[model samples]
Target: MKKPLKFPDFKDEDKAADWLDKTDFSDHLEPSDLKKINLPNLKSTKRLISLRVEESLVEKAKQKAVKLHIPYQTLMRQVLHRGLEAI
Candidate 1:
């Protein structure tokens, strides 16, 4: 089996993203090395911002958050995280 390259230890997310921009995942990752990460206690350091979002969209997000049993802000963060991963 081909040895998987270890992902570099980054000081912060920006550095990790910079590395990702320069590296191809196929060269560094293997299916067997993939593992589920659950950060139930993780707290993100967030910056306060005023964002203009559609009222209907906000209501839909609140409904989804209620269904998922998470805070609406937490649900929004999850969605944003997934969107960032797609880039």
Candidate 2:
């Protein structure tokens, strides 16, 4: 039987972060790791379109993105894609 993996427990957030920073796994990743990962391709080949939203809407989108810990542009793209699919 294989022994269960045991992970070290850190007492504090700083200790945990420091442990992660000190650990090196360069050998585990290949050249492909250095390349940008592409998202699953959407069949739509339509040209990109830009839309102007109200200042308040933009601020709200930014705030939501920040709260969710994601880039505002990424959140906007997700919202747009879902909206298009719904229509």
Shift of residue 25 alpha carbon in model 1, Å? 25
For model 2, what is the error of residue 30's alpha carbon versus the real structure, in angstroms, after optimal superposition? 20
Question: TM-score for each prediction?
Answer: 0.50, 0.44
lDDT of 2 at 4: 32
RMSD of each: 7.2, 14.2
Q: What global local distance difference test value does model 2 have?
A: 0.66
TM accuracy, model 2: 0.44
Q: Which stretch of 10 consecutive residues in model 2 shows the poorest summed lDDT?
A: 37-46
Looking at model 1, report the run of 10 residues with the lowest lDDT sum: 37-46
The total number of steric clashes, by the backbone 3 Å criterion, in model 2 comes to 0
Query: Measured by C-alpha RMSD in angstroms, how accurate is candidate 1?
Result: 7.2
